[model samples]
Target: MSDISDFLNHLPADRARTAFDLVHYMLGKALKSEDADEVLTEMAERIGRAGVPLDRATSIVPLLHAEAVASARFWERGSGARSYLFPYTPESGDGYAHSPAAVVHETGEWVRLWLPETPDDTYGIVPELKEAGYTDYLMAPVFMKSGMAGTFSFATRAPNGFSDEDLAFLRLVFPALAGAQDILATTRAMQEVMRMYVGAEPQRRILSGDVHRGEVMRIRSAILFADMRRFTELTVDMSAEEATQLLNAYYDCIVPPIEEAGGEVLKFIGDGILAIFRAEGAGNVACFKAIQAAQEGLDRVAHRNGSPSFDVGIALHLGEVAYGNVGSGLRLDYTVIGRDVNLAARVAGLCGTLGEPLLVSDTFRGRIADAGKKTSGGPVSVWSVGVHALKGLHTPLEVFAVAVP
Candidate 1:
């Protein structure tokens, strides 16, 4: 570990005091839950305020994401920070290959350019800095303990550029800054992964310390259950890769429309999807949106079908459900559980038997009626499939088939 105290002892008294104060300020901001961009911007501003002669600074940190890498740039003009997300592809035309940050990253060493003295043919950002009236530019690599690397570049417009003392101070503090950034980046990556795997609302609950098994909340919502028709028959003869591709294609057709209609997809059970449209205020908007989503999903799948077609069955129900963590102490899943959820699944099973692509339970239809005609644009019509006994339930359940327009 790099000790700030040890480094401060070597500096002259006045310089050491100023450096210590600045380091403490930076460290305090970093440790107080401030984000990476905020910390970096504050560090640059503080350095300039302490007479370090910094006019511009930029930091490029690579991310574990599908698209862009994150970066922040600060200019002295407004002392404001601007962030950018550079895409990973179309690499040939971005001019990133000839940037000073690229050189520092490739060589794992610092690159310094004195604008007036640097050769014109230098393969980096030197020419651009010279034109921008910057007298000097320096780029340093920040190599983390995990082998990930980032770049930090500093530029100055001062007549004499950075003094030796200023450069030395920056070199001493770089490690601490990089360490703070790594922590922030790792936290962000974990949150992103959680959001990707579980839905956003569940991830938020888990992060907020709702991890104990049986920690749950009862909430009214419209539950949606959907599954591919004849999935086993569809994939029995195909290779694993081809089967996987078909499943993805099917999801591509169905998932987005549900999300667009304000539903949270809970999980995928084999070829089936479980999602919920949450109730808002005192209305049955959740039920209405669930019905709309089911219709849109079926339409999308029908539109995507060609010679080798895929079909799906979906069902919706509205009632109270237990939403939270469940399972053994060693492992837990953030999901919903209740009779309503079970009822939704059972109703979905009737879709195939009734020869209907979409089905809605009596409970859901009742809620829509209770919300009044204005909420649902008047009474909606459905084909009543009289009370039928479902597996595990002794009482016969009334179900209705949705007539898609």
Candidate 2:
């Protein structure tokens, strides 16, 4: 307490007051902001207005995602702010190893370079900043509650660079800034995890206040249900790690095409994937997109197939589904349940029994025919696989096989 008091007492009176106001803002309004980019842009401008001549500011934090490693936001005086996500690098952690942020992470301390005054050959960005008239660059560490270090960096075009008072004031305000940033980042990370495990549509609905148990929404969509063939038999002799690897490999082929075709993957039931395509009131358009996605997914699986290769059965149908929260207490699950979903799954069973990789319900085919528009990969055609009685269902379903081009 005494050390902090002395540090505060040593600051110029005006700078002390500025620092206090900025810290208060950091602890208050900044944490309430939706995302880090908004907070960083406003804070940079606010601090500059408060007598810190910063021309640029950046916020970097570790991201919780399957495809991305970390996220960075770059803020400039005139250009506002832009966000960038670094993908997972198979070798090292991308080009970040040679970055100033990495040095701060390694030493748990700040790194400041007096721009052009210092040799710029050590880092490529230094020369670029110097050329852009930046005279000072500082990277400070922000220790997050997750036991990882984030960073806030600043740059200035001021001729004399940042004053000693500027550094002191920033040092005083950093704890509050760290708290605000960590709070926002943690919330974002949780949202990312939600999207990863439960999928995008479910995450959006759940976070948008559709969270009450038994709460459901009746939605009309084209359903696509697919499962790996011989999953149990193939995995029976393999280790857990191998089976997981195989499933992930298969999903990589399946999930991407669904997403690319404007469909949402709702769940991964063991080796099975349940996805939906909706065009609001247009069931034909939804069926068209679902058909395209299924075709592309099979092509992808075929392309990615190799040693110990596997096959998949895909089913398409169109109807209403109950989309929303289920289960009880803290164990709530946001998913879809309806006759159409069941029909889609039942059609998937026909894929194996009928010896076809792709099967569609009669309702699905009718919708596609209504679409009438020329679909890619030639005009869509199907072969009648004939109706067959499926387990747990009273009426026999008429299933058709998607003819391979």
lDDT of 1 by residue, 1-405 (tens): 146665554555666666666677656667675465676678787777656888888877666654565544454536567777776676733566777767777888898888889876685566777888999888888776556677788889999998877776776677766676666666666676788788677788888988898788776788999988889999999999988888888878778888998888888887988888888764388888787788888888878855359888998888776777778868888887789888888888888888888888887877666553656455556778778888977789888887775
Which candidate achieves the best TM-score against the true structure?
A: 2
lDDT tens readout by residue for model 2, 1-405: 235565586578887887778888888988887766788887888788768889999888888988888899999999999999888869446467767888888898889999866787666578789888999999988888877678999999999999876777677777887888888888888899999998777788888889899888877899999989989988898999999999999999888889998998988999999999875666877888888889888988888855568999999988877786788788877877887888888889778777899999888888787674655544578778898887777899888888654
For every candidate, C-alpha RMSD to the true structure in Å: 3.9, 3.3
**Model 1 global lDDT (CA atoms, 0 to 1):** 0.77
Q: Tell me the spans in candidate 2 whose CA falls farther than 4 Å from its real position.
A: 1-21, 24-29, 32-38, 77-80, 93-108, 114-135, 157-159, 209-212, 235-239, 324-329, 374-379
Predictions in order: lDDT: 0.77, 0.84
Error of 1 at 170 (Å): 1.3
TM-score of each model, in listed order = 0.82, 0.86
Off by over 4 Å in 1: 1-18, 33-37, 66-76, 87-108, 113-135, 144-148, 158-160, 280-283, 305-308, 324-329, 370-372, 375-379
